[model samples]
Target: MKILNPAMRIIFLLSVLAFGIQACTNNAKEETSLKMLQNKVDSLNLFVQKMKPGLGELMTNIQLHHEKLWFAGTGLNWKLADFEIGEIKETVDQAKEIETDRPETKSLTMLSEPINAINHDIENQDINQFKKDYGILTQTCNTCHTANHFEFNVITIPSAPTVSDQDFKTLQVR
Candidate 1:
């Protein structure tokens, strides 16, 4: 093989060095950007932990889930009804957590039976049974509200479809 001249050798070496330096710079920039993103995520998480959500917000979530549960169970969408029931139960648990200072409402004992009944009805794909249990659930909610001096916060079955965005039909068969 022919030998490269001194100038050509120097040029080749310099090119390799320059490429290496650029690669290192790019890696540093990427690492710095990753660190910055991680820092921002950590900051946001800290802020969220510092902020405790109020009872009203949690209760509103429960109400929305309740509505969805009603539509799902009424439409004979058993899976959706089950999902909504789980969400409602979770929201109620979250509300109880937020209201830890108040001991009396710690456990939604009144809701347990109705919730279980609804779950059983959904499992059996029994719409009529679900409706009957749902009525009992609504009455229980009203009773709880009255006991808590929130009698004005009455819940009732919807005459027509309330949530228009979603199709309350079974999406897929499991």
Candidate 2:
């Protein structure tokens, strides 16, 4: 067995040293790439975190969406006051406009045309007339939902509330 010459040993040592340096360089590059990627992800997360909407802004978004749904198109559901025949938009419109403290917007809308008609025919003392119109409005809401493929979302006319819409019955009657 002959010993390696000093020159060959030195070359072998230098080759091993070069490979060790290359491995360290590759590891450093991989770490740098991983840190850049992590930083980009953190930057995106911070941007999203800063972009959150305020409560009022969120509420406005929801309200506008609903308004679009109920008021956007010129469908039969938007016109005919008879909830039974079609159109519950009148109810929503009336409720949106009422200035009363009681938020009977649903009730006011549910009883809108019927209340007007009842007031007109008040002297008749026709319970049947009011009842019939009430049923019509209520049934119209249900029917509209059904026709629009939302049959599961049933809307019934709320029962008479303890809270009356009329504070002044005589004036209200007038």
Instruction: Score residue 24 of candidate 1 by CA lDDT.
Output: 100
Candidate whose lDDT is highest: 1
Q: Provide the TM-score for each candidate, comma-separated.
A: 0.66, 0.38
Candidate 2 differs from the real structure by a C-alpha RMSD in angstroms, to one decimal, of 15.8
> For all candidates, what are the clash counts?
0, 2
Candidate 1, which ten residues in sequence have the lowest lDDT sum? 98-107
Would you give me the overall lDDT of model 2? Answer: 0.47
RMSD of each: 10.3, 15.8
**Residue-wise C-alpha lDDT for candidate 2, range 106-168, written one tens digit per residue:** 343444564456333333434456456545645755664566565886655443323344231
lDDT of 2 at 34: 100
Per-residue lDDT of 60 in model 2: 40
lDDT of each candidate versus the true structure = 0.83, 0.47
